[model samples]
Target chain A: MKEFKVLMVDDEEDFVRTLDERMQMRNVDTSVALSGEEAMKKLEEDPPDVLLVDLKMPGMDGMEVLRRAREAYPGVQVVMLTGHGSEADEAEARRLGVFDYLRKPVPLDQLMRTLKAAYKKKIEQAMVAASFAEEGDFESAREIMTGNTKKK
Target chain B: MNESLFMGKVTAAMTHEIKNVLAIIRESAGLAQDLLAMAGDSGFAHKEKFLRVMDKIDKQVERGAEIVTRLNTFAHVPDHEIRREDLSSVLDEMLILSHKLSRLSGVNFTVGKGSTSVVLEADPMKTRMTIYRLLEFLTPLVGKGSEIQLKAMKNSHGLPSLGLIIKTASLENFCIDGILADPEWNSLEMEFGSENAAIEPSPERDSFVIHFV
Candidate 1:
């Protein structure tokens, strides 16, 4: 099994750093980005298997980050972790294809399980896309990686 | 800008900040616990005590987080001028928000076990304000060690209504006639009337019912 990679994006320096250490203690490869802009730059440099993002931030809030990530790196699963998101925000996030929505102050065990599930989903999608590519189905492989199936 | 909307906006923003602060506290405490667990039992003294204190911090964080979330929801009440809301839920939020008043007056507010859901279509802000005002009026009148049980029910006209069942420590000290005569009572009645609602003592004289029309 490859090392599970996650990029946690939030403006709260103390919170994200502490969480990053906890994830590392659990043997997961984790990195922290203080802002959405930093997160985007990191995604370009090295995309993680899963993107753990906060919905409310100072600049380029979580939804915009989720949108741009899905557009630029469709293979990476994005999970939304927010403290003050409203129902409307959750609906919008779901519409934009969030892997999971979790509230803040979440139990560590629960968060770990969610992250594992998200990472598993990302791997499964990649494996299926690779299988299609092996059969010379480049279009289907692209569709699988992008999570977009043909209309007909 | 409307006063209520302005207040709501400010409150919503502050609650978000409070939530972030709580999240940081929670994560920091969790990391401390994680480090302690990884260090094993050999190196650290009072490991059990430290773990116990961390557990307390975790519980307090949970409690604070719940209160902040409720307050954030309350802050958004002014977002809609009029909407359909369950009376029971509205009363529940009011009880939580009025904890300070409850402590000051030594009156506990709770929903009656037999309470039913009664959805009302009206101004959400006005509805909450009406309940808060009633609580303010009744808290001092009922005195200490009293309980105000809110129940949702349909009125004689089949309209949704709230019944405030006042259980005072001393029934002899509770005089409905005297309370109705107070100048504040008259003002409350006028306020209720303006909102297309009416408040009057129940037939038993021990409770007040607000009928919404």
Candidate 2:
């Protein structure tokens, strides 16, 4: 099995630390950022397969982080893990192409399942883009990789 | 905002923080369980006891999360000054929130599973307070080891109401008449009256009806 890399961004230090440990135990390569700014910096440094982000933070909220990541690294999938989220926030997250929306104190098994699904999605998209590139259709490959082409 | 609304905002924020705490505890316990699995048989001592402890931690975290989630929902009750809310669901939440008070006052609180859509158009905060005050007045008179059943009902007038029945093996020291005459009950009645609601008691059946307009 391929190791799935995940970047978990939450302002709660203890939660991020413990979750990081648990995800590592499950054979996932997990990294943590204490704030949305730090998460963006980490994204720039090394983009992971899935970005597990919290909706609320002291500065540069998760929605902003998600927006910037979507603009800069369209390939990375995002999953919102929020303690305080309203229906409007969830709708905005969905509109922004979030892979999943989950509430806090979620069971680890459920979280793992979502992460796996998101990782699989990221891998499948990458594989499709690679296939198009190998077929010498660079424009189609770029369109697929950047999510500019609608699925048929 | 009124006092209740202000307090609701504060409580809602705290519940979010509590959720984060519960999540951390859950993840830490999960990590311990995962490590134990990797440790295998010979690598650890008292493995069974350790696993049991981990299981207890997981269970407690789940219980705590459930309580906090309910509290979070309750904390948001005052957000709407007046709204259409299901009476049965409100009573269900009040039952859980009042569990500790019932236990301490030596009363058992039970809510009957009624029609799910018994909704009322009223002030959410006032509705909760009315039910809470009724329980407060009844618990002491009902005495310890008494059973109380609360049911959401649609009254004869086609309005949503709450029915509270108290059953005691012995009513020796319990006086329903005196409880009804109490100043607190009078004040609660006045408050309910202001909300276009009424609190009435049936001495024959040892029950109370909270009628909402």
Candidate 3:
């Protein structure tokens, strides 16, 4: 199996195609969704370890996608990629439970590092949930998997 | 708040779209390069040439993206009513935005280095429009193949000023006084006056100065 799976959501087809190729070259399993709605669909069909979504897109935007994805699939980590960065937008994305927010033309090394860290976090969460499930504490395991701790 | 500002907002949004387009182009070219590298010896016969072409595409995408980004900033200039700004950067942006118009008039605009950065307290939208109007007024009078040099400086009174020095032959025929007296100049003067600014004919007939106090 691939090291990790990532879903890239953007309206830019060429960007997705190229970035998808680059991620694949780095040994990451990457999928592309052209719109926010399509991204939500992809999440339901095959939830990945991480999601890299563009902030501005037709039909639905990155923020909405992040909000819905976190609500529906709590296991997936989302990183917002935006061409336009503003304090409010970044704050809003963070409040919506994005793992990280990055600007466009992100250097490959930096992006890779972020992806690796996020993927690691996902793995750790799964391991913790597995431990709880093994103890037959299924509800607590589900809570841990969904990041529903009262402190959070 | 005004029509120009509304249009600027719309144009700014469009420029963002253009940036996205450039980003996609860059990515596509990058992907092509990646595939070429992966292909190894089995890749297309003209490997070196193909790589060079990709490099060219990447460079052009960068250039396009930079312009879009600048245009986006220009589009947002009207968002504020008045603010402190570096006049040189403002001039550079307006020159870029009006590049096509200058080309149509067969005029080229260049910015000359000033002793120091001239920061101004003014309405950015009106300031740009004022400079554009000056260019519009002079481009035709200066004739085709003319060059205009601009500089940002503090005037004799130490007020922030923009200097437009026309570099063309036969300034005798193109009288600054007569042009300044025209109705178009009056309208431009009124526009600047609305923003509590003034456009004055420089002591030398070769140029004009915009003063923002």
Candidate 4:
């Protein structure tokens, strides 16, 4: 659990940075980005297995990130971090294939728990892909490629 | 896209959750009040814990209401892209967003003596969003219950440049690198360009200033 790379994005620089510090204390590798754009740069430079992104921001806010994550990296599990938890927002995040939605001010324990769970999902996804490879199901493996969780 | 939307959704969702927390506080506070009156009539033995719970509920409910209001203002009037909207009005709305935040963040704000409102032709929605973004950054630096004064008035040269000065002891310690990394920050900086607005730390005061031209 410790040393897992995580990207935490929030317009609230203090909040995100503070959370980053806490994650570090817990032995998790964390990076902080104040805005969505910054997060994208970091994401491109090095894609973390899990991204914890704030829901509100100016110009390019969180939803935009969700929409882009699918096309960009496809493998990282994104957890929507928000101060305001709305039904529409949850539905929207789920629709975008977000791993989960967590509201802030986040308790240290709750966030860590979420990170662990999100990491589990990522592992499951990896295992599923590996199985497809062994079975010689190239089409199925292709379907399971990273962010393509929308099994329609 | 996901980043921007994620931030917005989280704020929106937190608003609702905060509302629920407020609802409980309100109900508990109201119940305690009713009990206090009833107890008074019966002369019931004092339960110190009851009083403490009542006080705690009162405080949390107040805080919760403020957070709800901030969310409301942010949600209700985003992107008012018309003629230059009144910075005072826009700021006042944003204040509600900060209301629950001020007490703890230790953010102090004050309008300048020369403060006055002037008209500028800009997109209302974008301007509001820019300030909103700035506050999001500022709130964390100040201790909780701290005051953030918002003064909107015109600047010299007849251009309506709204002034935002964030104050607090920790303001100096606040992280700035991340703010610059934000896309919205870039958007505002790009929108205003180098020629117009000024965003910098004041040498004389513990403040971060933003001038909207």
Candidate 5:
């Protein structure tokens, strides 16, 4: 099986580092970005299958990152994990197409399940897009990849 | 800026910080547990003890998280001047907030079960403050090992009301007339009057009911 890749973004160094270590131990390929700016840079250079981001951050909060990521890299799934997120924030995240919104201090098993589900979604979308491309439906394939497929 | 709003803003910020602190502690302790599980019979003599301590830490983190969440919600009470709020939920939150005071006085605060929902449109901050003050006054009077069960109901005029049912081991010694006659009771009446509410002794005299307009 291909390695499941996840990029975690948070301002707290200790938290992100510990989470990274735990994910790695669970056979996940995990990368950490301490700030939203760093996360954007990492996404551009090496986009992962899923982005696990914290809502509150120093420079460029998670909402902006979610917006930019959805626009530029629609293929990558994004999940929000925050310690102090409000209902409004969750609503905004859902509006921006976030895969899931989870509270901080979540059990490792729950986090793992969410990440795996996100990765599976990414793969499923990619396969459908690939099928469209093979059939010479470039526009449909683009729509599938960008998550803008028109409803019948 | 309104004084209540300013205080609420500061409190909300502090609650956020506290939540972050708890998250870090939870993750750090969790990491230790993860490492221990991965160790797998490395002959660590204190493994069981460490696990037990970690369990305690996890439980505390859960407790702290709940408190911070409630405090955060309470801090936002001043955001609105008058809002429609469920009487039962308001009483529930105030009961949780008064846990320390109850412990200090050796009293237990509970919300009566199977109570019908009573929604009221009033100043959120003032409503909560009135409830807190009432609990504060009654906690000491009821003395140790007493129970104060709050119930939401309709008054004789069909107005929303909250009934404080006091139960103590020495019920014979508890005097509602004495409390009603105390000088502080007059002050409490004024406070309740300011909110357009009235506190009166129940027919049974074992409880007090606050009638809301």
Candidate 6:
């Protein structure tokens, strides 16, 4: 069983504090940042395996944060969190290459499940990339890592 | 801090606080209306309590409205100036706010029956906040089950100004040995005291008064 590190961002201090405490209790390694800039700083210093980002913030909202995170930390899986579960939100997040979108106030089980799905995606991608590199296939491995997936 | 940023925080907090008050008042008033509609038909019990709750809810809505108006007035106070203004409206607004705090006071509140709106010009918001702090200061003195009274009347206005009399059995001298009694109030007093406003205690009467200049 592999442990995954997750970066979480939100502007509301109380909300961030409570969620951090709960996620830590569930054996998830979490690092918190108040804004997207702070999240990027944390990622650049020590990129987490997964990121859980909140939708609303004072400045530099979630979409812009996601764009920056993906550009800087290509390997990290991004999961966008919103306060709504509307179809429009899901479609937009999907278009942005988000691994998963969880609506708030989400049930505890649903959040854990979404994190698990994202973690599984990362693991599967890592395994394939590793196999490609083992066969002296550098180009194929880089493609996999960069989400290109050099298919036959 | 930037004025807009500061305003945003104040507006957000005030809006949320007033909204909860509105919701509670609506629920209680609606309950009273529903009870009245049913009393004519189902011979329901607790009809009196429902009516009482309806009256209480109206009082609450009035208080909530005053809070919003005070916030608006606070928003409009021109940069430091003293002139003639109606004090009655200010006192009425403060009383409404105190009722919101003291509906559970189970205690009595009084107003000196007068036909005049004691006029004074000062920072209305800070004045309200000071009065608010006084209410906050008094509430815990009498604990939850005590009564409080507030009165406003014209003073000589020659040397002193309009008198806002607050009577509370629970308004203790509860001193803060080193610091000001209330930062919210004491700070405003310190800043604005240069204008000659004074808070005097009536030695014989169980009351304290703020004569706003």
Model 6 bad stretches (over 4 Å): A84-89, A150-152, B1-213
**Cα RMSD to the true fold for all candidates:** 2.2, 3.1, 5.8, 18.9, 2.0, 18.5
lDDT of 6 by residue, A41-60 (tens): 89889988889997656688
For model 4, the stretches where C-alpha displacement exceeds 4 angstroms are A145-152, B1-213
Give the TM-score (vs. native) of candidate 5.
0.94
- Restricting to chain A, the TM-score for each candidate equals 0.95, 0.92, 0.92, 0.89, 0.95, 0.87
lDDT of 5 by residue, B1-213 (tens): 799899989998888778778878888898899889988978899998999999999999988888888898898999999999888988888877998998888999999964467887888887887788888898888889999998888887777888889998799889999999988988988987666588988999999998886
Estimate, for each residue in A19-132, the C-alpha lDDT of model 2 and write its tens digit.
888888788998999999999999999999999999999999999998888878988999999888778899999988888999988998899999999888888888998898
Question: Between which residue pairs do clashes occur in model 1?
Answer: none
Candidate 5 at residue B116, lDDT?
68
TM-score of 3: 0.69
Worst 10 residues of 4 chain A by lDDT: A143-152
How well is each residue in A69-124 modelled by candidate 1, as lDDT tens digits?
A: 99899999999998878999999999988999999878789999999999998889
lDDT of 4: 0.66
Better of 3 and 5 by lDDT: 5
Winner by DockQ between candidate 4 and candidate 2 = 2
Worst 10 residues of 3 chain A by lDDT: A143-152
lDDT per residue, candidate 2, B1-213, as tens digits? Answer: 889889989998998888888888888888888888887888677889988998898899888877887898898888897889888888889988898889899999999887556989998888888888778878887888998899998888888988888788696666677877888888878878766588788657478877887
| Candidate 6 C-alpha error for residue A69, in Å | 2.1
Q: What's model 3's lDDT at B26?
A: 69
What are the per-model DockQ values?
0.71, 0.72, 0.35, 0.03, 0.61, 0.01
Q: Model 5 over residues A15-64: C-alpha lDDT tens digits?
A: 88888887888889889999899999999999999999999898899999
Candidate number with the higher DockQ (2 or 3): 2
Leading candidate by DockQ: 2
Model 1 spans > 4 angstroms off: A1-3, A136-138, A150-152, B113-116
What TM-score do all the candidates reach, one by one? 0.92, 0.87, 0.69, 0.44, 0.94, 0.41
User: Residue A143, candidate 4: how far off, in angstroms?
Assistant: 2.7
